[model samples]
Target: MKAKERRNNIKNLLINSSNPIKGQELAEKLGVTRQVIVKDIALLRAEGKKIIATPEGYLVTKNQENLITKIIAVSHNVEDIQDELETVIKFGGIVKDVVVEHSVYGEIKAMIMIKSLYDVHNFMKKINKGKGEPLLVLTGGIHLHTICADNDEIMDNILSELKNKKYLIY
Candidate 1:
């Protein structure tokens, strides 16, 4: 009912959620407007919460303690987007984000947080539903993805698969 209480509730929801929660979904659950959710998120961040706004929605960044995180360079057309994402997921890697380098804008990144086949499907669907081009389009189909896995074997296998599929950039 109050601003402080609402922000606490927002943090609780993010902590318990396994998947990203859309702003609208949060607003609906909290009986507030989407703008309020946005403001709450900003305020939460100001409080040093690890809430990350991904393309799918809002997620609290998990601890990478003892986890292996690596960045992979890849190149592919928009149509191969699903396949590339699927490959990473297939090899037990969590696609954390996509990064691109623009000549004028330097480097830009976005949180993807793709962890499953369903996530891959949902990401592709959203891209198709929107008119905006993938970030790779800005750099001629070249980009990087930060992936996380449990061990070296999984990371090695993911890299091998991406390389085999011609998506991995040497």
Candidate 2:
């Protein structure tokens, strides 16, 4: 894999993982050298990924310094996905993750990490072109998004906008 794609994969793995992952484990998982993993870690850190080296291994911080997060319930049809994501991005909120409660499985979550309109468009294209179905379909368009911002003001603005757009639930 290319360095950029590999770094993105590394970020996705770290973001989705609930536990720390050792460098060697990452290396083996990505079919690269341990040294490459180490360099990728450094590059990711330089790019403000909030990756910290723990005694166990490397763990991506869910709550970074000065970052405020809010989970909001929303219900919208699949066709409105881009509009919903664009709304969040326009308000300066980072789309951190999506969560849905399943009747049989309980809470199911996926890391989105969408920070810009480009990312949102890419996500929409991937979903539209591929067979990958959105988790919201399993929950009748009702779901939750973990939005992050540098402060509460931005978050409040996002919530208000979503509410005005009829995306926010309650």
Q: Best candidate per lDDT, number? A: 1
lDDT of each: 0.92, 0.87
TM-scores for all predictions: 0.91, 0.66
Clash count for each candidate, listed in order shown: 0, 0
- Per-residue lDDT of candidate 1, residues 1-170 (tens digit): 99999999999999999988999999999999999999999999999999999877898987776789988899999999999998888978899999999999999999888999999988888889995789999999999999999999999999998999899998
Residue 26, model 2: Cα distance from true site in angstroms: 7.2
**Alpha-carbon shift of residue 129 in model 2 (angstroms):** 0.5
lDDT of 2 by residue, 75-140 (tens): 999998999999989988888778999999999988777778877887888888875898899999
lDDT of 2 at 44: 97
Q: Which regions in candidate 1 have their CA more than 4 angstroms from the true location?
A: none
- Report the CA-based lDDT of candidate 1 relative to the real structure: 0.92
